[model samples]
Target: MMVPDRVEIDAAGDAVLAADQAAALLGVALPAFLADLRAGVVFSIVERGEGADAGTLRLTLRRRGTERRLVVDAATGRVIAAEGG
Candidate 1:
């Protein structure tokens, strides 16, 4: 018997998160993050698809303008934040 350590889904049902997801996470009151992406302000970890379609990254925008990803056991992604002084 073999156990799979990581599982990746490439179906249409679960498409990779895009910049739009960033906007929603940021909770743009009147759409502010839109310009950020175009200006390369927002950071991301792009995971290219098999072929033809690619360059999608799973990210959650932050007020700091630079959010660092962490690994945790919880379902809802949570990262330890630092107090910006």
Candidate 2:
């Protein structure tokens, strides 16, 4: 799959906020977050549940062959969930 450029993702407004929140939760800087996003990270916007207008941003990152996922609430910029470290 083709990963989006930072500018393209940032253009959506909420994407950048979600990325920033996820990065902060992981204790990383914005540049590092963007770099990771560029380096085969998987990102998507998903609805919280049925009837939920706002969605969460899901990010999957791999490091040293270990993959982890972070779910960030787009409306509040909060990390709602994390998996696999």
Best lDDT among the predictions, by candidate number = 2
lDDT agreement with native, every candidate: 0.37, 0.52
Q: Which candidate tops TM-score?
A: 2
Candidate 1 achieves a global lDDT of 0.37
Clashing pairs in 2: none
Decoy 1 TM-score against native: 0.36
Worst 10 residues of 1 by lDDT: 76-85
* Candidate 2 residue-wise lDDT, 1-85, digit = tens: 1222221134453444356655554556778867877885634443343245346666565433445555665555555666664
Stretches off by above 4 angstroms in model 1 are 1-15, 46-85
- Please give me the total number of clashing residue pairs in predicted model 1: 0
Off by over 4 Å in 2: 1-11, 14-54
Clashes of each: 0, 0
